[model samples]
Target chain A: MIKKGDTIPGIFSVLFGVLILAYIKTNEKMVVMSADTYGGIGPGFFPFVCAVALVICGVLLVLRGIKQNGNVDYFQLTPERKENLKSVVMLAALVFIMLLAWKVSKMFFLCLPIYVFAVNKLLKRSWLFTILFTVGMTLFIYLLFRVGFHIRFRP
Target chain B: MSFELLMSAFLDLLTPSVFLYMSIGIILGTAIGALPGLSATMGVALVTPITFWLDKVDGFAMLMGLWNSAVFAGGITAILINTPGTPASITQAWDGYPMYKRGEGGLALGINVIFSFVGGMISILLLILLAQPIADFTIKFGPAEYALVALFGMTMMIAVSNGKVVKGLMLGFLGLGLSTVGLDPVTGLKRFTFGNMGLQSGIAFIPVMIGLLGLGEVFYQMYDYNKKRAAEELEARKINQSLGRVIPTGKEMKKWMPRNIIVGLAATVIGAIPAAGGDISAIICWGNSKRFSKDGENYGHGSAEGLSVSSTANNGVIGGAMCTMLTLGIPGDAVTAVLLGSLMMYGMTPGHTMFTEQLDFTAQIMVLMVLANILFLIIGLATAKISAKLLNMSQPTVWAAVGVLCIVGSYCISNSYMDVIIMFIMGILGFFLKIYDFPSGPLVLGLLLGGMIEKNVRTALIISQGDWGYFVQRPISLVLLILIGASFLFPVVQGILKKKKAPAAE
Candidate 1:
């Protein structure tokens, strides 16, 4: 079982590197001149420095991981553990269905039943309770965001 | 600080809309916290869109409620299934799961809930009373001071990583670098977008959070799911029957009351500091409880004190984090980062002027925190047993639902399909990172702090006429710098001293 303690920093380093490279590429003009005095360096200067520092840190991390025998093994998914994959999928489906219902038909209330049914079927929960929970949640969202705040359902 | 202003602020917060928003927060917090792999940060991020249309007070109130309740409720899943709902609750599962196996799950959860409530409420009270003074003190800090504060926050990762100073610093700098993505805040130039449109805005914080915390867990779970189970595993894993009564005995409560209060207070104070959060508080408290307890050996075997200490410390941080955000305009955690964004969306920028100018808004959020705590206690107790049944569900069904939620959450953020793609990519990256030994907290922290660090550095330097001396000249900045320096060196020095003392003691 991969623990949280095992995996966060590596992904962060790569992502940080990607971000730095991206920033440097996008704002080319900002890098060239110290036009404004946000500091002794131009506005781009701090971010550029921060980015370089981040890359150095990332390189060190990858090296450390290699030294510790860390690699793709941390990312491997075993078959038995795949049973729990349904949780993430179910949550994603719920959101997709809700958004689809609301977006296509503007029938925000329709999403409530789907939510209830999904929760019920997935948890093997009591139908009565699931229904109540679904309805309660739907109504709460409606009343709070739609009715009270007067937000329009995205069309 | 005027009486009239305070009265009006109180009135603004007491309105029915604020209560309604707070209620929504509590309910959402409980649901998200009760689920395994779902974290409070993700919950807040997903819910932020709902608040986009709300009034400033109502939106802030809701986020606050969610923040407090989510941290407390995370223990529910940990106690029941040995799976922590949030990173902060991971330590709780150490003792909590053992207690569950010993058939004291209900009692453990009950104790955890009560202590969490007490811890959260006390912290809120502290925030309400001390916010102005703290803000006033913190406001004295300038750019150099903020940089120092950021440095101090980064250095604390040493304590967090458990003596792994090199790894912690590596991770912290990595986070700081990731934050540098997107167009420079002051100069409008991009640093590292790599010709990708999505990269133009830099890396989105929500995607990183969802990927690292949420998807990363999924990958780990998949690995565990592949492991073959012993025949007895099914029987051993069956949940224990409820103990009927929810509350602990009066004697038991009385014995732990003083300790609980002390733990709660200490946790709150620590939590108020930026980058330090519930996870750190809970672990620190749990460690301290073991160190001090006469029955320390029983800690992982169903000790009520252990549960109380961990839960209290975790929940206590919510209010403390809020104090930093409302008073000093610095969000202490991811949830508050979303809240800060919401505040910006509502055209309400939090600062010294916010207290004097937007007193009502500030008061409303404070009141909502108190109300949310009460609601969380009531709802949490009532739903404890029932919520645990989620663990029994078939795997496929649950995955389908979560998949839907991820899609919806991503799409809702900007009403853009591109964001969904970004979310998916992040999720994959997060999964891979989890397989490798890396910390995601610093990455998230970097993403959250990156823009602010850039914007502030520029503003501060401009004001100082491009003089570096200005940063050192300010009293507040000088103090913060010293503190940052101390934080960085403390662990290294301590480790060396320990190494030297070890041979002498031997």
Candidate 2:
């Protein structure tokens, strides 16, 4: 009955803290204290303290995660929750595709409207309304960013 | 406080362009605040990046107008529907919806608009009177005291986290740790930059803010929308939309005015506390007013006085929050955290300098705050009837629009694609944080104040020749540490007392 929600962040923090500790150890320049330093404390001191605190807190979270019997089991995906997950994945994919398209073409004006159109379609809007919305939103963004701010999308 | 400077500020804000921006912000705030899923903090976060392109006065006028009106407009949905438009309006729903059920929708709406304005103006007057004294006192603070102030601000994470103190502290520490990704403050040595040019300057605050507040909320709403739709609870409710009289009689107003003034003053005090914003203030005020009122029996059923107190308290926090942020460089809540970041973007630092070097700008802001409340009062009253139409906006449309804005807004900050990617990553992380019931406010406060806390602490260390005793040796720092300890311990003691009282009550 352990909550995956609590456990995952706990483990993540512990690993993250360990990673920081490992990275700082490999770099001699990132010392917590140096004899020649003005304050006798080096750049790594604050982050080092944070890392240790993170590890300690992470351990506490893991213990709490194991002890608490939460209502929702993160590992078990209900049908509606699955649909919710899919919608988010689709949304993230849409944005990623827009970014990739903009990178390849550098034509934000063209890419933006198409991105909007795709998003509206994903949201299950009528085709006609989606087209109109895409056009209206694109023009609004264009007029605001391009005409008003005079920001050039392309070099 | 001089006449010339005051007149200059008035002249600056009296321009048509400034008024226009303020009007647009008011309009947007009304729509945003009347919608169930959207929040004032999210609206402010979304608009903040766009404001960077405008003049300081125009930009702040828009922000001030948006913030004040959004808090006020939340009552629109609270009265019309049982659901609150924003967290601040939660208490508004108690008496407001029931009053609407009794066909007093217009009266409830009227009370909300009038009392919110009154509360907002009262808080503004307090801000004007008190901010200078606080700033002058804090001007003499040493680095240790300043560091303690930042630490004290971070402890607000516990308050905002809504009983998840450990998780809040963890995320706060995560923010503080992430803040050290760039150059070391004391030494010029770089810490976590894997040699990327972007990492040299560190993670940008705006993009992360936009991601967490904007995209994060959208994603969660999408998920929640799906759940609601699945449950078939999306069916439109049939309620009386007919609004009766729009204004209360003078006799009625006189009856409620004293109680409302007391509640507004109390809310102002609560709002000045770090992390205690409109939502918390309103709840405290509403509960306390009910406990003391002669008509306490009618509180939840349908008391106009209760609605007035709730409405007054929520907007009353604005002036108090601004006072803290402007004078102490501490954000009372998420919106002010974003505002603090925006101020930094404008090449202005808050705190003592805001009164000295930036006094003109500060005066302009004060004038704008007063102007914003007046503007919203006129507009909110005029548009109260039409506000119900705002709730009809499609959830999908809002989600898509907010999502695009989040992506584009982050990119608009220096036209960096890297920022967009960072925003996306943070969006996913923020979604998870929300799913797990973690409060994003503390995370944001930590991110915004992390550098201040670290920089001040290190500087104090240097001043004390690396002696840790410096913090305790200073009177102000010692006092702040005691306050911090009390802040953490109070909740624990309260929880223990509640546990002890529960069994006895049962």
TM per prediction: 0.78, 0.97
Per-model clash counts, in order, read: 60, 0
lDDT by residue (B334-451, candidate 1, tens digit) is: 6776676567556676666567677766776777777788877887777766656644543333343444445455555555555655666566656644545455556555566656
Off by over 4 Å in 1: A1-28, A32-38, A62-155, B1-17, B90-106, B155-159, B162-183, B189-204, B215-220, B227-240, B293-297, B394-396, B494-506
Estimate how well candidate 2 is docked, as a DockQ score. Answer: 0.61
Candidate 1 local lDDT, A1-155, one digit each (tens) = 24333334654655765676575567556453364444557655655666566566666655665565544354344554454556546644554565556667766567656765675666556767666756765676567555765654453
Candidate 1 displacement at residue B316 in angstroms: 1.8
Docking class of 2: medium
lDDT of 2 by residue, B261-325 (tens): 88878888888899998989998999999999999889988899999999999999988888889
Best by lDDT: 2
